[model samples]
Target: MATPKHDLPDDDIEYVSKTEMKREMTALQQLGEKLIPLDKKQLATLKLPERLFDAILAAKKITANGATARQKQFIGKLMRDVDPEPINELLNKLAGLSDRHSAWLHRLERLREGMLADPKIVENFVNEHPSVEIQQLRQLVRNALKERELQKPAKAFRELFKLIKQYIPEPALPGLEASGPEEEDEE
Candidate 1:
């Protein structure tokens, strides 16, 4: 059998012992398995470096008196490289704030602004969906226009609308459960 080629320089190859090579091979095999289905674009977007990986691993190891595994993982990522003093102060200040739809409204404004920029696309959409409420479509376009001018991208707004559509109760879609007979009145 032919000798196996070492990609590294002779000096570097000599510096890495056989045990190191075996360990590296195992790591590569694991990485390949984890990454097989990810396309180049998805891989590029991960932005994971050695420091990020190390930070995540380190975060995973921190345990408090009653922290769960999921909570530890969440706090680890959220707290990584964050300063505690100012964050605590901010949290204290915002403690009274309710999780309302206001933030989502802001996001919707951003989406509206983006849609207005592409007039042709908007026109085409309207043409395609002639039965859709013209006033509603106009409102959507106007909101997108406002968001773009404010320098907020429309993605957040679009996401907010998508979430609303998904979560908010709607008149049942076609072919869903039919309205049944009303229950008899009890004494």
Candidate 2:
């Protein structure tokens, strides 16, 4: 038998299970699937290689089930040569601020503005969200008004927004359970 050619000992070679490799391949395929739905402009942002970009475009066009599966597998194989971290990071950044999330933030801003504009809005806020500490809310509002009058830093104003966030739950994604910090828990 031929002696081992390399310097490293045979015993030092780390082994990976077949199952782990398959799991990684599946994840890559799923990531590729996400890229497929994006328009050409969005795909351009990823700067994929010509072969991989063409493969993705072809995958988008295929309707036959078996052919689509094979194309997806090919894309997964191509993805193996690419660094997925940057792709995943970019995809996550793109996914983060959905329209719903933006609208929710705007609503919170409007609520804060309304409270500042009208004392009655504070009462309405308290009534709408009974879980909040009424005394703390009022104090924060008063302090925020005083800060505005004195031209001081808007510490209480920002704090009031934080308090409101703690009380109001973020809008849930469709078909998914709402996952945020417990509303009753004081931070």
Candidate 3:
């Protein structure tokens, strides 16, 4: 083999080896991942029809008014080209959850009133309802107690029920206790 000399003025030389090619391949793969376009299925996942779409569109209109023509186009294409079934399902689930949460909140509001009327219960609530901000809970408690005070007949009925339950629990059951195992274990 002839030993190549530097005097042979060649402008290009092979510097890229298998290791460098592999490194380049990995870097290109990462870049390709970042550049990959969202498929129709992935796009459809965000076009939530009910509450989520309403929320997103409201926000989009507010923020996107300042965006350029290309940005607007991109957003419009994204919204239209995507599959929306997942979004609809998610929104339905969220709406259901919201309804359940609201029912719980109403129950909590009723409980808050009961607690406010009873100082002991109020103290217990103040300690237990950690998620309810202290100031907000205090205000709600005040309102509930005031409303309860305004309902004289209801208050009286509740008090009477409490008293009745406290005193009228003397009924006896003939056989309420468990009768142990029914048969001996085979294994």
Best candidate per lDDT, number?
2
The C-alpha local distance difference test score for the whole of candidate 1 amounts to 0.44
Q: What overall lDDT, based on C-alpha atoms, would model 2 receive against the true structure? A: 0.78
**lDDT per residue, candidate 1, 21-138, as tens digits?**
7675555433333332334333233344444344444544556635534444443444444333332322222342322323434444444444556666556655765665566666
**RMSD of each candidate?**
18.2, 13.7, 22.7
- TM-scores of the candidates are 0.23, 0.49, 0.27
**Candidate 1 residue pairs that clash:** 107-157, 112-143, 112-144, 112-145, 113-143, 113-144, 113-145
Cα error, candidate 1, residue 39 (Å):
31
Ranking the candidates on TM-score from highest down gives 2, 3, 1
What C-alpha lDDT, on a 0 to 100 scale, does residue 1 get in candidate 1? 100
lDDT of each: 0.44, 0.78, 0.41
lDDT of 2 at 135: 95
Tens-digit lDDT track of model 2 for 103-146: 66678778887888898999998898888899999899899899
Compute the lDDT of residue 7 as modeled in candidate 3. Answer: 62
Residues 36-88 of candidate 3 have per-residue lDDT tens digits of 24333332344333432333344334545455334433444444433433433
| Runs of candidate 1 exceeding 4 Å displacement | 1-114, 151-156, 159-187
